[model samples]
Target: MSVWLPTAPCTPRTCAGHTGPVRGRLPATALLLAGCSLVLAGVVCVPVVMLLGRAPRDRLIRWWAYGVVRAFGVRVRVTGRPQSPEGAAHTGTLVVANHVSWLDIPLVAAVLPGRMLAKSEIRRWPVVGPLAALGGTLFVERDRLRALPTTVRDIAGALRGGSRVVVFPEGSTWCGRGPGGRFRPAVFQAAIDTEAEVRPVRIAYRTARTDGQAAGAAAFVGDDPLAASLWRVVTAAGLTAEIGVLPPIPAGTLPGRRALARAAQTAVASDSANRSAESVHH
Candidate 1:
């Protein structure tokens, strides 16, 4: 089992349901504002990408994510920054982060310059998909195994093209949940085949309630309304998020994809557990 500790205000806290209307309304209103921005970004920013070209598209989408963070009333704190491969300014790099929330996308974007490879379903999400596409995001359909080789090739090409690509090894958000969640290992294929240095990131939401307590207390996974949960989170007071980038997990003697994924997962899970334990002691 792995434990998690978040060191920011965004960590989840479920105040008694009776905890005043003001607290509840804040997260809701903030989410509404952010959602509206996504709608606008999808409609306006995505089309602008075609006119402005890929570079501008990437920049604008990042700006859009920054706006979403602001609207959500969440501030981000980063520790243990990732190192881009030597000469990577002109090459592709792979960024791997442990999944935590829907906010993970914007959080990663805000911290590092990279386009993300997300599940194909995300692209179909109302308002979100278009904006993500504008950001040069690649969507993968996990169920379509036949298409995986192509996907891996695409990722390799992106890295070779000098674009930094982000991947979530957990394959889904573990928002407010403790660590040690099984890692899928599928995404590791791209890094291995491409010989890309995998940058690993650990994310934890720190809230006034408790360190990483938001994972279980906050609503994520299992048919919970994403928008609603987001709203609840933003309005809740004193929420902050922090992301820590571990050293790049280079292609080591670790023989295969499973080994690589495990290495990365272990690094992440250990960090999460340590943080959680430290929180308890504090």
Candidate 2:
């Protein structure tokens, strides 16, 4: 298996069952419609957003992303500061996070709008494909080992051009109920090449009924259909997506990409552990 093609053990039967409070069919349907409408609206506005300057375009993208998540009745709570992308002296900011669900994409963009590092398959997705391309996503051919160097170079070029890039280094989506996949070090090479600032962000899903325990409803793990994941999110009541932005790791300060990847994984894992401990204490 290719290094970029890591797999997660989580599946719908094993991990995505929703134990949280659920909304009525009518309301859930309404939320589903609202979420789809927002996504369609974003796709339509892509051309217009492209015409704007960087700052305004980023602001618009952030707003659109937040709206999409909110339309699904999923609340977002962000902790810790995201490093600003406006550092003129440095390369772009590399935002790395743990993958939990399809919602993770917009959830991260809602706070830190940037070019996304995604699987090449997403570019072929129905409505999302065109939007991702227009929004400047960096797609990787994960199944092809030979494509790794080129992908890394593309990421490095984007960073050198000062584009903030969001990546899920786990390479696969986890259940968010336990330790996530390892942070693959390949993408970190881009940060190393461009001397970019690596922002380690941790994503978690929870519900009010669970007393802040991790929510499995949002996990889009192995072999999970997109429609199934979408339904789970819309039907889930009081689902909260939390973004924990840990301190930034200066790529220049790190000895190499492997060390940088480890440092980032440690920061994100430590934060997750701390949050879990707090939930237990309460």
Candidate 3:
């Protein structure tokens, strides 16, 4: 599943002739420029969040994410909004979404206010790693079976303390060209233990232009290198991502973690399919 990830712009072979290819290797430059702005935003906002409070921090983080997405030339069109918890505090809620590309993080963060659960390996990625860590992302070491219980407990404690967390139960990214992988039920345990509300968010990518395809630009599928993916995104014109924040499924209504995960996955999957079909019809 791993490839050398050559830094070449996506060509006709991969993206058809609809998108521009900004010379091979130049993708890194575009990404670096985008990264710089985001890093600066992160630097400034992290402090504000630390010195201020949750509401201020969440607002700034949302603005920061919106600015970054815009700076990168990606237009985001948001659909439905998330349901705020009824009587529960903000931390007593969990947000789950479908995974498509690395951009998904910023895209979701742009609207949803919370820390995300990411793989532990992401902590080592250049530029992004530090920002994520400073942003208070919780790293999950999924490969270790023994660590699951402790990690779940930690997350439960954080939730009970009023931490709204985002999780991608898919475990892997789908190309956005097909149905994504299923959501894992394990993370739902945190929501269950804390009696948190679970919200479903669906992200779908499409072309800005009526005649183009944005899959190559936005999807981070198997073996797609970070450099190449950036090239595709920067070069592609009229790329739009639509985020649909669906209703929250009351955790109390679900039997347990498995039931919660199933309901969420079904809701997300159904929404995603409908969204894609709508895009095609329009």
How close is every model to the real structure, measured as TM-score?
Answer: 0.76, 0.92, 0.80
- Candidate 3 lDDT for residue 214: 37
Over 115-171, each residue of candidate 2 has an lDDT whose tens digit, in order, gives 998889999999779877987988999999899999999999999999999999998
Worst 10 residues of 3 by lDDT: 1-10
Candidate 2 lDDT score relative to the true structure:
0.86
| Poorly placed runs, candidate 2 (over 4 Å) | 85-88, 125-131, 272-282
Writing each residue's lDDT as its tens digit, candidate 3 over 102-166 gives: 88988888888787887788899887777778777888777776677776787787788888888
Worst 10 residues of 2 by lDDT: 273-282
Compared to the true structure, candidate 3 yields what TM-score? 0.80
Residue pairs with backbone atoms closer than 3 Å in model 2 (clashes):
none
Ranking by TM-score: 2, 3, 1
Let me know the TM-score candidate 1 reaches against the reference structure.
0.76
Candidate 3 at 179: error in angstroms? 1.9
Local distance difference test scores for all models: 0.64, 0.86, 0.71
Model 1 lDDT tens row, 207-238: 65564454342334444566656665666556
Clashes of each: 23, 0, 3
Best by lDDT: 2
